[model samples]
Target: MVNMSTSQSNTSLSNGTAALYPAAVTQRSGGETWFEVGRSKTYTPTADDIGHVLKFECAPSPSPRRLISVSGIDVPGHLDLDGRISSGGTFTVLSYNILSDAYASSELYSYCPSWALSWTYRRQNLLREIVGYRADIVCLQEVQSDHFEEFFAPELDKHGYQALFKRKTAEDNVALIVVLEAKFGNHGIDNPGKRQLVCVLRSSDGNIWFTSVFNSAPHALLAMGKVDPLHPDLAIDPLGILRPAAKLTHQLPLVSAYSSFARVGVGLGLEQRRKMDPATNEPLFTNCTRDFIGTHDYIFYSADSLTVESLLELLDEDSLRKDTALPSPEWSSDHIALLAEFRCKPRTRR
Candidate 1:
C-alpha cells in the first residue's frame, strides 16, 4: 500500500488569509527520521521562477537526453502557471535519487543485470525521466561529483537553470547540486528590486519569506537514525544527510534504495488561496519498502505564502512493478521520482 500525504485543515492567518499546509507530522517509531547535510551548491529562486515550474527533477540515467518543462500528473497543456505566477503563481519542484553506477559492489544489488547499472545507460534513462516532467526545481542525490560538474551542470545549464553543488566528502563520489531555472527576473513579478543576496525574497508588500530552495539527495538507503549498525559505514548512509544543525529547516519523510532519498523545504507565510482538492494531494514515495510500499521521498512546505496545488503522479507505482527490489524488470532504478506543486502568494496591496 502507498502512503500519501493526507490533507490538513487550512490555517487562517491573523489577517484572515486562508493558507494550506501539510498536517504537522513527525516520524513515527521505526519511521523516517532525518539528519542534516550541506550542499555542494546553493541558490535562491527568483521571481523569474514564479511564473515557471521550479523542478527538482532527476536525470533518468544521467547518460543521455534532457529537455524541459506540469500539474497533478499534468502536462504542459494543462499546467497553467504563467497567468497565476504573474500575481500568484504555481510551480512544481522535484526530489529524485537516480541510482549511481557504484551499485555493482553491493551484494543486495545483484538481482538486476550488471549492464543496466552502467552510468551511461542509467544516466541517459535518468535524463529522460527528469526532463519528461518539465519541473522547475530539481534536487538529486547519489549523483557522482564528476558527473554533476561535467554532465548535469552543463546539460541543465542548457535548460536555463543555475546550478550549485555540495559534495559529501573527499572520497570516491562527490556532492549533489541543487538546480533552479534562472530565466525569470529578480523579485516575484512586481519587485524589480535586485536581491542583496539569494537567501530570502521580499514581495512588493514587504512580506519577507525564504530565499533558498532546500534539497538533499543523499547516497544511503536508510534514514539517518535508522542506519544498520552492522554495515561497514556503521549504518550511516554515505550519501545521506544526518545532521539536524546542517538542515536549514525540518522536512518530510524519506526512505532509501538505489536512489531513494531526496527532498525540498520551504518557509511558511499567509495567503488567501481557497481549499486544495484533496484528490490532488499526492504522495512523494519514489522507493518501494519491505512490507508496505510507500513514499521514500517528500517535499515539506509552509503554507504561509505558498498555496498547495496538484502534485505529480505520473504513473501508478504498482503498475510499474519491479520484479526483485529496485533496478528490476519494472523500473530501471529502485526509486521513483517525487514532485510538488505550489502557488506563490500574490503581491498584496500595501
Candidate 2:
C-alpha cells in the first residue's frame, strides 16, 4: 500500500465528492502512460504494477495557492520474509536524529529544497518512516521538546509505544526514547545522569539494554583538544580501543552493534557490503549535509547477551546526494536512521 500525506486532512470528504481531490497515479514507462488508479490518499498496487514506474498526484478540492504534486518511480512490494526474518525473543531497535524544526533553517540547509524542509511536510514524512520501520524501540535525537509532547508522543502512543523524553535545561532540543508495549511485561527506563539516556526492558529471555548516543569525540578532537569539556562525564575515548585517562567505567557489558558489522564475515553480506563504505566497512554516513557528511549516530546493545540478526539496509551516498544533500523530498532529516535486529542468547547454566 502506498500512503501519501498532505498538510490538509482529507478525513471529512464524502465518497462521491472525494474525487474532487484526486490522488492520481501514473506510470512513466511504456512511453509515459497515465493510469486512472484512484483519488484517495492511499493506493494499493496490483500485480501489473510490478515492472512499471508509478507516480502520484493529489489535487485538493479547494486547491491551495500552489499546486501540490509529487512524482516518483514506484518500487516493488516488500519481500516476503516471514520465514527468513527473526521472530520471538528478537526485537528491532532504531536510532534516528530527526533534525529539530528550530535547527532546520534555510541558511543551515541551503542545499535542501525549501518545501521539503517545512516542518509540516517533514513531520509527516518522519512519522511515516518511523512507523514503517515497526521497531520495538526507537531513540530520537534533536527532537523539539514541544513536538515531542504535542506530536510524536501522542501519535506514537497510538501504535502502542510509550515515550520518555530528556531535554536540556537550556535548550529546546531533546532526546526521545520510545519502547513498544512488550508482550512479556512492562519496560522500565531511567535517566541516571544528564545527557545519557538508558532504557532496560525486562523479558522472559532476560534484560535487553538499549541506548542512543551522539558522541562527538572525533569531531571534538578535530575542533579542540578536549571532548565536551563542559560536560566532563559525557566525554568518551577518542579511539574506542583505548581507555580514557579518566577511566570512565560502567558495569554493563555493552558493545557497538555496527562496529560488529565492521568485523569481517561477522554480519557483512553481499547486499550489506554494497551499502557500506569500503574503507571503513560501515554505513557510508549516518549524517549527510552540505558542509559535512559523516556518521554521528549509533545504537549500542548488550552484545554478551544478544546476537545481531539483521540490519536495516543502508542507503548509499550517491542516492542521498540526488538533491545535493539531505532533508530531501524522500528523506526527512539530515541523518539517516540506524536499525538493528537482535535476538537473545540462551542463558548458560553456571
Candidate 3:
C-alpha cells in the first residue's frame, strides 16, 4: 500500500493515478476528508473549483447485503461546488414597509383599540410572506424595537440574516429600520435624529454597499426646509442634503421616504376646485392634477461601471409609469418600493 503520509507532503499526486488503502487503516478521523490535486502544476484546487467524486467503503452489516458500497458522496471544499455560482452578476434587492398599526401607541389617529392586535397578527403574516421572497438583501421600515427583537429578529435569523438600528420614540410615533445581510458585514451611519444603517459587502467578486434610511416626522425635506433656503449654509438644493455625504462615501442610497403626500394631494385638489367657476369645476378639476408631491420610495443603485448621472438618467426613464393609475390601499401601501440594478465591472486577476 502507498503511504498516505508521503502523498500529503508532496502535494503533487500523479494524474490518472488512484491511491487506495484500507478505510480503517487511514489516518483521517471520521469527520476528516481527503483532498486530491492533479499532476498539472498549472492547476490547483481552490474554493472556486469543483466536480470531484468521493468514494467510501462500508463494512458488511448483519443483513442480507454484504460489503455495502456508498452510492453518492461529493467533495465539498470548492466555493463553486454544489450548484454554487460566482457572485459577479447583478442581484435583486427589495425594500418593504411592514405596516405596524398606526394605532399601536394610541397616537392622534382614531383607530379602534383592537386595531393594534389585529395589525400585529397581520404584520407577522406579512413578514412570513416577505421571507418567502428570498431576496439577497432586505431593508425593512416601520419595525418597532421590541417587536423586532421579540419577533422579527428571531424569524430572520432562521433564514441567515442580521438586523441593525435601535428603537427611538418621539412623541407617540416610533420609527424603526433594519437591514438583513446575506453574507456581508454591517455598518452604521451617525445621523443623530435620523438613525440610518449601512452595510458593506466585500466578496472575492466585488464590493456592494447598501444604506437604509427611515425618516422621522418632518422628514429630510422638511428638516432642510427649516434652514433658510437662501442661506449660504445651504448651497445645494434641500433634496441634495444627503447626496454629498453619500457620494463621498461611495454608498448606494436606498431611501424609504414616507410622507402624508396622499393627504396633501387631496387638500391641493380641493383648493383648486374652489378657485374654478361652478360650471367649469368639472373640466378644471379633471385637468388639474395635484403635483405637490410625487411617489415616496426611491432607490439609487450603481457599480464601478456606472456614474451618478447615468444612474439618475436610468431612474428617470424606468422608475415610474406616468400613465399607470395608483394602486388602492388593499393592493398597495401608502408608499411605493423602488428597485434598481446595475452590472459591476469584473475584478481584475492578480
In order of appearance, the predictions have TM-scores of 0.46, 0.58, 0.35
Clash pairs, candidate 3, are: 47-79
- lDDT, model 1: 0.41
Full ranking by TM-score: 2, 1, 3
Task: State the lDDT of candidate 3 residue by residue for 172-291, as single tens digits.
Answer: 222223332223311111121222232221101111111112231123322232323333333433444333432332233432211111112233333333333343111111111112
Candidate 1 residue-wise lDDT, 186-299, digit = tens: 224324331111011110111122111112223122123232333343234454543332342323233211111112222111010111112223233345533334443445
Compared with the true structure, all predictions reach lDDT values of 0.41, 0.54, 0.32
Q: Identify the leading candidate in terms of TM-score.
A: 2
Model 1's C-alpha root-mean-square deviation from the true structure amounts to 23.0
> What CA RMSD would candidate 2 show?
14.3
Clashing pairs in 2: none
User: Model 3 — TM-score against the truth?
Assistant: 0.35
Ranking by lDDT: 2, 1, 3
lDDT of 2 at 71: 12
Model 2 per-residue lDDT tens digits across residues 30-114: 3443444454677776553455445565321211111111111122121123423222255678888788898898999888778
